[model samples]
Target: MTQEPAEVFAAFRHAESLVARRRPLDALVALAPVLAAEPDAPSVHLLAGRAYLNSAQLLRAEDAFRRVLELDPSDHYARFALGKTLQRQSRLTEAQTQLRMAVAMNPLPEYQEALGEVSARIAVEGGR
Candidate 1:
C-alpha cells in the first residue's frame, strides 16, 4: 500500500496531533503508514519516538529515538528523548550520557532538568 506524499504528510501531521493530545496508541496507528512511507524522515521517527515514550513503550521508544539519532546525530531533542526513555527503563548511566550530550548540544531547561534528574538518581543509587 503506497501512500501519496500528500497523504503521508497529512497522516504525519495527524499523528503528531494525536501524540500531543496524549493518545499514543492512536498516534502510532495514524503514524504507521507515514512510517512506512517515509522511513528515512528523522522528524517522523522523532514524533513516533515521542509517542512511544509518552505511552511508556520504553524499548520501542528507545529504538525510535536511536533511529532519529542515526539519521540526524545533531538532533538534541532526540537525544533528550532517548535519555528520558533510557531513564524510564532504569538505564540511568546510559540516560545520563545521552542527557549530558543533549545538554551540551542545547542547554534547554528541560534538558538540564532531565540531566540533573538522572545524575541525582545515579548518585542516590550509587550511595545505596
Candidate 2:
C-alpha cells in the first residue's frame, strides 16, 4: 500500500521516539511501513539500524547500517553503528576496520572509544 510522504515522516518520527525510549521491538514495528515507503532514505535506514542494534538483532542491524553507508558513504554514524554490530557478533577485525573509518571521518569521542575497545579486544585475542 502506498502512503503519503507526511504519513511516512510521521511513522519515522514515531519509530525514532520508540527507539530512543528503549522500545526497539516497537520501533521496528513502527518502522516497517516507513522502510517499505522509503527504502532509499539513509535516515530511515539509520533509524532502523539503531532499533535493530538495540534489540540485539545484530545481522539485521549490520544490514541496515550497510544500506545507510551504501546510500551515503560519508555517514560516520553508520560506520560506527556497523562497527558496533560487528563487534557484538565477535567479528572484531571487520569491526575494527569500520570503526577506524568512522573515527577518521568524524573523530567523535564515542567513536574513538569504540575503536579503542575493538582494537584492545583484537590485541588480546591475537595474543592467545
**Model 2: per-residue Cα lDDT over 70-127, one tens digit each:** 9999999999999999999999999999999999999999999999999999998951
Question: What's the residue-level lDDT of 10 in candidate 2?
Answer: 95
Task: Name the 10 consecutive residues with the lowest summed lDDT in model 2.
Answer: 119-128
lDDT of 1 by residue, 42-92 (tens): 999999999989989899999999999999999999999999998888899
Judge candidate 2 at residue 108 and give its lDDT.
97
The superposed Cα distance between candidate 1 and the true structure at residue 9, in angstroms, equals 0.5
Scanning candidate 1 in windows of ten residues, the lowest lDDT window is: 119-128
CA lDDT, every prediction?
A: 0.93, 0.95
lDDT of 1 at 56: 91
Model 2 CA deviation exceeding 4 Å by range: none
